[model samples]
Target: MQSTPSYLWSTEDLLGQGATASVYKARNKKSGELVAVKVFNNASYLRPQEVQMREFEMLRKLNHKNIVKLFAVEETGSSKQKVLVMEYCSSGSLLNVLEEPANAFGLAESEFLIVLQCVVAGMNHLRENGVVHRDIKPGNIMRLVGEDGRSIYKLTDFGAARELEDDEKFVSVYGTEEYLHPDVYERAVLRKPQQKAFGVTVDLWSIGVTFYHAATGSLPFVPFGGPRRNKEIMYKITTEKPPGAIAGIQRQENGSIEWSYELPITCRLSAGLKDQLIPILANILEVDQEKCWGFDQFFAGTNDILHRIVVDVFSLQQASSHRIYIHSYNTTTMFLDAVFKQTNIVPHHQEYFFEGHLYELDPNLQARHFCRTTESSPLTLLSTSEQPEDVVGVQYRDPALDFPKLVPRVDVVADCSAAKSAVGAAHQTLRVGQALRRGRELLARGLHWVIGNLRTECSRILEQRRGAHSVLACLQLTEGRTHVLCEAVPAGGRAPAGLDVLRTRLRRVDEELSQCSRSIFDFQGALDGILAELAKDGQQVHEDKSIQQIECCLEKMQVIYKQFKRARTCLRLGYNEEQIHKLDKLNLGSLARRVLSIFQNGCVQQYQEALALHSSRMRKVCEIKKHLKRLSNRISSCSVEMMECQDCLQGALDRLLQTENWDLAAAPPAPSPVPLSQARQEMVLGMQELLEQMRSVTCDLQLNNSIIERLGGAAPTPSV
Candidate 1:
């Protein structure tokens, strides 16, 4: 190791020993820069030169702010003493910070947010660059003091880091044993060593597990069994729960206690924070890796969380003076319920009486916000009838308006097998007939409203253009060009007043084009919002087809619109002689060629653009109409199933009610056997199959299916 001269920069003393190297604080002699140097321990049989070269190559390419910087690499004369120069983090590792507080790292919520954001962002950057920090734990994260005096987090140690595409055979096991994901250990323990085909998602799982530990100060899952307990944990990670489990203390209303693996990791967060976190967390920890949120989501989520923090802080001070008013739509039920139960309405919507002066707004306001429906309702019903509107636009109070309510039904069908046939018979005989009648009537009314709205806008634009054109024609006849030219003979020259008339017509066209563009933009925004909602559902055949058709149409429309935009830009610069000659032959007076060209081009472009956009949008509507054909077929099948389930439910309800009313003490403890309806069961099975097929489609296609919206409605039960 002494043959090659060591580029040693000895300044600060040696710090401590790591698992594989000796760390020292040092400053460069020439540059006067502070850095940390890691000298690897002697390798008995392993090739130190090859290992250090690979590690240095990977380290030099990483440029994330949250990742430690590798300054330089040096090898001793013996070719065994390899030293890596790295950025020095003065604050030290997070493991050191956690050791300070016994109560599971008692970090303030704000500090926790900062740490979490930094770590996720750094890891996300690495993943994007095709690298995975296979070993990510508290010990490997280094914290440094920034200019703002805030602790900055950085991920270190690239010795175990592997290129995402590397397929080399596995050798020595890497990473801390306790923190290893099950898959990692499995690959290491294989009889014939094989390179694991892990993706970027694996790094994310480790980050999630790390955050869970950071928040609660413990691992969510504890492996129970012996020597290879870590392996057992890994098994649980893959086979037991594809998604990471959340740990928390939960209490049942009946005083029974049980452990829940599905607890949201953010359950400890306040209501405001939890509300903001749920969706983002769901995206980050999805079962399907494709749907998982990457670095982009982390930044967006961080901004949202920070905004919420500000609002939360402000709300605390005005908690007493600023009151939250809860209003009900109907007082009749509430009054009656209060008389019997000593409370107003359901617990979730029970009105809170505040000290501040409260005012009631008009009733029957249009519902604009999209909110989740209650547990009892499958559809998110809109209450736009403007009655009993509180300070908020809409009232989402339950109709029950009763307190101390009766027992909620735990099951809809008791004897699933027997109930199916009876339900099918009743549905086909009565329910299907009724639903068909109702659906036809609803479709007719919706069609009328849509057609009327489009016709009115089209008529208005046509009238404006007609009137503008007539005015321009009348000017030419009244003020002949020669007479106008004589009048325009300034002290030295003459021009016709007819030029003014042409200018006026041009200006009018410009105004009309502006209004049309704004109208189209508004329409597009509405469409975008609707599509966003549809994206959340993975199933729904009709929506998938409709969304796909609309996207293709939109892309084509955008191309045509771009061409029109370019033509308009050129016209605004001034019309050439060729365009002027064409207009002159049409007998139109010259009135600022540049302005005239713009008006003429815009007139043509606006109509073309609008037509393209409208035609594309109409194509979407047509495609959706086609999907309705499939939906109709599915609905017919659903009707058969719905009846079967209804019969099963009613029978179960009858038996329970009879037992309660008759007080039959000698009755059998077990309820009578109720079987599922075969026809209804088959119908239900069909809906599940359709839903699964929809899931196989791409994200863009799935959005059109409106699965998210359907889920909240009485959509059929999807197959697992």
Candidate 2:
């Protein structure tokens, strides 16, 4: 380095602090630029000579956008201690973002993908350089916003990183306790007698844990009192065969372990994304080294997800919507092609509107333009068998890569009374026409939004309604079987050994079914009430009606503008310093502003009222949708649990039927209870019915998204 990076700012202005080092935000005096100075404490320096120098050497050698840039090594002015000057990340760490209350359920799907992409890229770089990041966690990953205003993540804190080949092993344990591999935890934290060496796969285990935490906003494995308090259980839970991305624990010390094969219901990642992610996690977080995916495979899997574009799209012709995944960069043409493949609708026959603006097929038209993330409203695709003519709509798309060279103090579309020339007046008229057309389309959209919702909700309700009846029928059949078993057991005689388990499972089924029924009924009631309220306040307004109203208001404003122009011409005929100035300022400009305001007020009264009503409905719809979603999740989970119950019940029923009094084994075996056998048959069939019905009742929300490619001249809307 020509000149050493300086720590001119106060050390007290800290950016982050860790166990071994304190990072401060400092300004480099040599170049007058901001940088992060990592000053190690004496404790960090006391490590083995190689260990102390390894981090700096590795960081210096590694060069990637995802890896923190090493500027220069310098010394503190006060103590003359060695320190590091690295790239400054003003956005802080990934941990800070995760800690926000809003992200309690983990990052939104898009942000999670970004983190996944950056971390994978960064790790791939490290692997290429033969480096192992022994301690990988969210806190160690720094976040910085790029010039494009999107987050760029960099791997930092190389204190525990070292060069390691694929087969190389080091018999040392170093990692956060929560993220430590079972073998490492046993040797280092457990202090057990062992001679197992750690390899590159240990980093995979850590990465798995980090990814889990990032995806779920919590660690994968935690016992009653954390990893430290119940070390053996945590180790056992992790090392157990048939692992999943999520970890569960037994309630009691002596109880059998409980494991979940899926992420929590509260996790914000979409089902489609989660389906792709869980497999990668399963490959990476394996307890058995032989089964874990190597770096190459890991890179391939993550890059696959990153490279594929997934978004929801809504088709009006089909009166339905679904998610689409594009393997190429998401451009408007690419989007239309993707839709064509999925829906068999030709691109030429399709008309697309995003956020009420028509999407014109120009070079600038991209995915960002059509970014409706919510299931309730997706990117609108108007699919007709025949192509339409003269599609008049606003198609100006903004960009993120650069700003337009706009003229100062200039407006694109001058309002009435503001046009000073014929060309300007023509442009203003065209603008008014566009605005009226947009308004008309908005009205159409509002109407379609409500009708589409009614169609979707009614369909869902019908499915759930049928499911409820099936469950009730199953419940009735189950009750009948249990009654038969009750009849078989004498009034005070001891029941069969397996009878208790059978009863317990039946009780669980009963409770879950009741919960599902209540949720569905409540959802139905809310939907009915909202629809009725809307129906009462609603009236059909033709698109042309609003356009006519606006057009008439514009005509009145144009008349005023002509009269003002004539008056201005008369005033100019007498052209004087005092008279012209007064006429232009007090009369012309003030009257124009007042008339335009009046004109706006007159035309938008109906529009504003309808907008307010729609906004209110949307908010109510949002809340109800959340409730419905929660209910849907519960029903789906209940269905899975019921299937498990059916399995357990089948085993118990088998044992119950096969039971015999062993004391009388020498004698002929007692006759099998015919009533009990009949009961078993009924219960098994009924349980299957119950599960099938519950599965059928699950909420199915579909969305169709065709986003304008990134800054595709428009930004994608973030989902709530």
Candidate 3:
């Protein structure tokens, strides 16, 4: 047993021990959160400090839900042992889940798919970041039970992880022999001190082996013999046929047993699942790296048979649209429910008319069955009382040329004008009222939509800032560890002066990064306030209020963007400034150059990447602002037209009141006021055009929201 750090960590129990370090279940004193602390021994041959630092750097750069999170790093004891505090997975490792007695028959197909997807996704993320987890194995993968009780598999144990150079070749042999590909095994068996270089494909092979173990509840090739076991395992991996058939046993009267490959357990997989999985396993286990199935191929193949369907919903009344992904087995009602949840449409008032027929959507009927009887056209939803023309008014028609002549012929011009004015006045008043109501609704919805998008973007920015903070903390730890090592050197042979300079520079960089973190917190607070205000029930929607909200969002986005720019400038100048003043004048040494390069790659490069991401998001915000401005202007124009129409109607009504004895039956037929009708028609068309624009902006906001959510946020909870 080892003593724990009294202030930061309180060790509850020893978890496990490895070759280089011992893991303990600990509680973080400040946050009071449970975490797994891996404390390395100072004298281990594994060079534990170096390995821990490298793992920390890699984990800081990679952010994925399916990857284990590195919380903090600390140097403990007089020996300067490194301890890594990481996310605690209460469900243990995947190996434990597979070998448990309850799962002796192997995981269900769905569970297996979940594990496979998560691992592959995590691996893909690593590859994208130019990293290779050279030691991907079942024991390196942990199972975490989420708050909802669903198991999430995360890739961990990055001690063997490496960043690959453009033309890099890995000669070091790492990982468990059982999970190694044939190519790796061949290299490991070479007599020379060095091995041939390998790439990320080795990880795919390990994943395949892990998948096999999970599917069969056994290793693909059993180890036999003592000292010669490695050779035997290599031979089996290279020359033996892949497992697909299971062995059956028969008993004779004399108690003799006969074994045969039979149906009792064929590769320990059901026929349906095997058909889908065997091909993937074969491709992953390919001996040549080039022939292995890449992430995109596996993703495409899996999605094709995954039974998911994308449903697009268009709201005729509100002129809003939403796209949702659902299972093919979901009923029509379920699909409609999902659409309504997103669009905020009341289910009772929802009468979805599609393809010229009234779809009486039964709650129990599957969508697939309903589509079978309908026309093959893509589904377009409409309110039962709404016409196509009502939702999307004729775009090309000139109102002046298209107005109908509604009055009969009249000899007296005065009589005709009076009758025409009466009818026109009534119709104009009705149209003006409708336009005013719809305009207000559109403004409200658009404001709300933009607010939602801003919330998501703000959340993503906060997540990115958190990652940056983690990296900064790790860099500080690296600085501390280096200082400790320097102090250990003999007093007669003082440590290099450049090391002191590096530590000072690191401290300055960390202080600047702390400022950046605070700025992000402020941005988040502002966004939260905006979201809360927007969410208030029955809040009045007016042009001024909407404009004020949009302006506020724009201002905050610009401020955050500027902050990111300033941080990038600080990172670049901070390193270069120090180098110019100190390192340039000193006698150049290899260690000093290495330390500076590490700082550049570790801190400056990461800041650059973050800056680029922020700039990209800022461009999106600019686009949103442009659309918001247009929406505000459109509402203002609509308001002016509505007021004018009301005034005209009021004047006509007053004139009609003066002619109290006007004849009803004997009134001469009136020639319709074509110009007035045309004006009204044009106004209606303008309102429709504004509605279409609102819909387009809403859709754009939704898309950006989804992108931000996927970038850093957790998967959205399915709507009930």
Q: Which stretches of candidate 2 lie over 4 Å from their true place?
A: 1-5, 9-11, 30-32, 77-80, 250-256, 314-322, 329-720
lDDT of 3 by residue, 133-173 (tens): 88888788889888887789999888788898434668777
Q: How would you encode candidate 1's per-residue C-alpha lDDT over 1-720 as one tens digit per residue?
A: 122143454424665565677777776656666778877776522655666576788888888899999877876555556678899998778776654322232243456667777787787677667777778887788899889988899998877776673222244556765455445556654333556555555555566556655554545444443225445433444334434334322132222222334423322233334445445544454434555555466557755564331211101000111111112333424322321231112322322111121112223421222122221111111111222212111111211121112122211222111122222222222222222222222222222233333333334433333332343233223224323323333232443333344445434544544454454445445445434433332122122232233233333333333333344444343446335433332221121222223322432233234334333443443343333333333432333332333233223323433533422233322443775456534533433332333233222222322332332212443322
Q: Rank the candidates by lDDT, best first.
A: 2, 3, 1
Instruction: Give a tens-digit lDDT track for model 2, residues 1-720.
Output: 112334576756888887788888888776678888888898887889888888889989999999999988887666766788899999989998876534555787778998999999999999999999988889889999989888999999898888999989998778778888888888877889898788898999899888988888777877767678888888888888465545666567657777867776556675557767888887888888777888888889988888786666555444334456555446877877767776677888776655555545553466655454554445666653533222222222111111112222222233112423322222233333343344434434643454445445535643543453454345345444543543454332454445466566656756765766676666667667666655554434432244454345445444544544565444233435335434433343343344344334533444455545555555555455555555544444444444454454444433433452222213333456554566545544544453443333322100101111111212222221
lDDT per prediction? 0.42, 0.61, 0.51
TM-score of each: 0.39, 0.49, 0.40
Error of 1 at 294 (Å): 6.1
Looking at model 3, which ten-residue stretch has the lowest summed lDDT? 393-402
Sorted by TM-score (best first), the order is: 2, 3, 1
Better of 1 and 3 by TM-score: 3
Hey, what RMSD does candidate 3 come out at?
A: 39.6
